[model samples]
Target: RVSMACCLNMCGAVHCSDIAILGYHRKPPMLDHEYMDKMCEIPLAIAACPTAAIKPAKITLPDGKEVKSVSVNEPRCM
Candidate 1:
């Protein structure tokens, strides 16, 4: 018997199949600075990253308040 799985979710009969393939997330997550500053907790959000991809970003708002921005490490993303 032959079975296949597309993205490592293993929706197919992988074990029953003679061959198996596992996939993972190649692309990293998207980060919205506006969303983060207003609604998300910066430190907690960074810590939640499994791969530590999210780094601390800082930006200066027009009002002189600190605005956080990027927070993504591409090499560390996956």
Candidate 2:
């Protein structure tokens, strides 16, 4: 059997096994367009992802406000 932990603080057998189980926090990225454009750097966020699951995107609200945003590819996300 194989066993592991998501973090070193959580487990000690990460390096001692042939098959180590790595855990992922599976959750979609929460986007706040208004705040994102004002406070965050979109490209930096996308590049920071190890899985490359984030991509640049645009959103059009019902009120016709076009907001620049980032999209998270859920299937590729880990």
Q: Each model's RMSD to truth, in Å?
A: 8.6, 8.6
* Candidate 1 lDDT, 1-78, residue by residue in tens: 677653343545586778876556668656656567778767865665666677787976667878776577889765
> What is the TM-score of each predicted model, taking all chains together?
0.49, 0.60
Count of steric clashes across candidates, in order: 1, 0
Per-residue lDDT over 1-78 for candidate 2, one digit per residue giving the tens place of the 0 to 100 score: 477764333343667777887775657656777667778788877766767777998988678999888888888776
What is the Å distance of residue 72 in model 2 from its true position? 0.4
- Scanning candidate 2 in windows of ten residues, the lowest lDDT window is 5-14
